[model samples]
Target: MSTHVLFIHGLWIHASAWRPWQDLFEERGYSTSAPGWPGDLETVAATRANPEGLNDVGISQICHHYADIIEGWDEKPLVVGHSFGGLIAQELIANDLVAAAVAIDPAPVKGVKVLPFSQLKSGLPVLGNPANKSRTVALTPKQFKYAFGNAITDEESDALHAAWTIPGPGRPLFEDATANFVRNSPAAVDTHTAVRGPLLLTSGTEDHTVPRSVTLAVAKLYADNTASVTEYHEYEGKGHSLTLDAGWTDVAEDVLAWLAAQGFAPAGAQGAAAAG
Candidate 1:
């Protein structure tokens, strides 16, 4: 049997963000986990009311959280992540804790160059606030609208805001410490090169937070790691909200197909196999 699948989430979001992916994998009979970032509230309502809870969520804490989940798995699971979670996935890979990984629009890791104006603009609030480094920071409605919901319509965007927007730890957003300081730490990458596991990176053509250039730059980092092989995909008109918007299911299906190709599933999974 293939290894289980584990998903790590990014800032301002919780494991619930992976619900669509979880549903798909569950249908395919694969065990899955969507462990929370430290202090992650289970629901959107709660998160809105308690943004400060996110303050305690730091890179080290979140990394250890995923590490615990990985330890409990029977085998080294295939790890996938988006945004800040992508950075976390790299950390686990460096530690030799995963069989495969997919980093979807990962945040800026140590040494990745070519920051996009949109990315810096999206992060301006946190970067502008000195206290953000050690606290939880919630986005103002305007800030949230631009950074995350610009591609979608106002109504749908408003709903998304109501449903998933929350304050998150700001440390990782501005984390400039050693790479090994947390997951994807610079030290870890240097000492633990050559993951030899399959790595996939998907970027949205219209993504602003992680522009096409930066995404490619990040891919080069993993390629630099001496990973046995790496795959890349770009979805047209897809934004930072690639996994939550209209075409999410197709994207999930594509990921499912890729996993099956990597032998993450049975041969029959190539067709209309049940969701794992």
Candidate 2:
């Protein structure tokens, strides 16, 4: 059977950012798709022209939007998500919608309590403005440099900012920050469930936005799961932009290897490997 892989992009970037990943997975015999959040425009230029489309979009809306897409698939997919997308992967897993999942530098959900100063600083662009809760917010190049490109060179950071940055909904940031205090917050996940499937949580050691401490805490939350597999991996010297960084394929290969070990290797991969 073909392994359907779903790629989920996070805030400040659009579904197009996963194009390279989709190509790589397809080459390995996996069918891939990357879906946009609700109200997302077709292109970055269009998103910039009318940023208001991203306003007031909360975490629940984004999750449900993707959940519907997953439900339409003929088979359960291997879900991979980055940053806020990572949190969404976990939420979908909690709903038993995926065959396996990989959350890379995912944002924190309720009960994850290892926030570092840098993580807080990275989120300040949205969290600092209470008014942003109902508005769309775009990160300044300087802010993007600090949050995502900290581990890369200035030129690379500038290039990435130019190519991938876009406006994002502000409400999800506020919702995640206050999730612990909110009753029945959409950011909540049932980590103890066996139906969550095999979950792999990856952390970039140098990631400022979702630091190692935060990812480690999230991994620990699932430590009590006896019926499902949960594993954690940390990439040395990597940053929040790991998915888009120069070493992105390395991370992707690691995920592929893990899936292979878990008995979910893409259909025809062995034949393709032999042909090569």
Candidate 3:
């Protein structure tokens, strides 16, 4: 049996953006897949052409969708997620679903109370209008630049926007934004539980969408769970685009190294696979 790695994408980014990571993990002998959020189409263009399927979708629905898929799998996967996907990754591990998880620049869960201005601004596109809670929202190039591409050149940011940006359901944003107030909010994760898979939470200091402060706060929330391994890493000059931008491999390589440290060798008796 081989270890499996599941990649989960965040808001405004199509699932296909994980293709590179999937290919790399496969080369290391791990079976992998990047399943889109519920209602995502087969391709970026197709999803953009018709995003109605995701309208009104919320965090719980998205979680259930992935949970169903994981339940069908033969082995618990090592999940790696970015942005909102990072939150989902934590939820999965906290719920005893996946073997372990890597949450990169993940949105703050319920217990995290720090709301940075950059994070607020990044979410305003959806949270600014109450009506957006029940609709799907798309970020403009300018908004994408501020929220995701600030650490890179404008030209590169624009190119990335054109390639991977897509409509994202506003409900997850709304759910997370109001998590601190909502009791039993779907965005809440069982961070206090001391018996779950090892978790690695990463942050890009330049990320506006989910600021480094928020991710660090999340790590603090897990500090009480001494029985489980929870680690944090910071990328000084990266932004939310670190997962898909020009330097994505660096972030992916770090994750590969962390997994090795956690004793998750590449499947099929392969030794720790070198990051290409």
- Cα displacement (Å) at residue 61, model 1: 2.1
Q: lDDT per residue, candidate 2, 68-129, as tens digits?
A: 88778788899999999999999998888898999999998899877799999999999998
Clashing pairs in 3: none
**Most lDDT-accurate candidate:** 3
* Per-candidate clashes, comma-separated: 14, 0, 0
> Model 1: per-residue lDDT, tens digit, 144-234?
6677667777776666666667788878776733342456553234312664577778888878777888878767766655536677888
Arrange candidates by lDDT, descending: 3, 2, 1
Give a tens-digit lDDT track for model 3, residues 150-249: 9999999999999999999999999999998999899999898758888999999899999999998999999998889999999989999999899999
Instruction: Between candidates 1 and 2, name the one with more favorable lDDT.
Output: 2
Q: What does the lDDT come to for candidate 2?
A: 0.89
Model 1's alpha-carbon lDDT is 0.74
In model 3, the worst 10-residue window by lDDT is 267-276
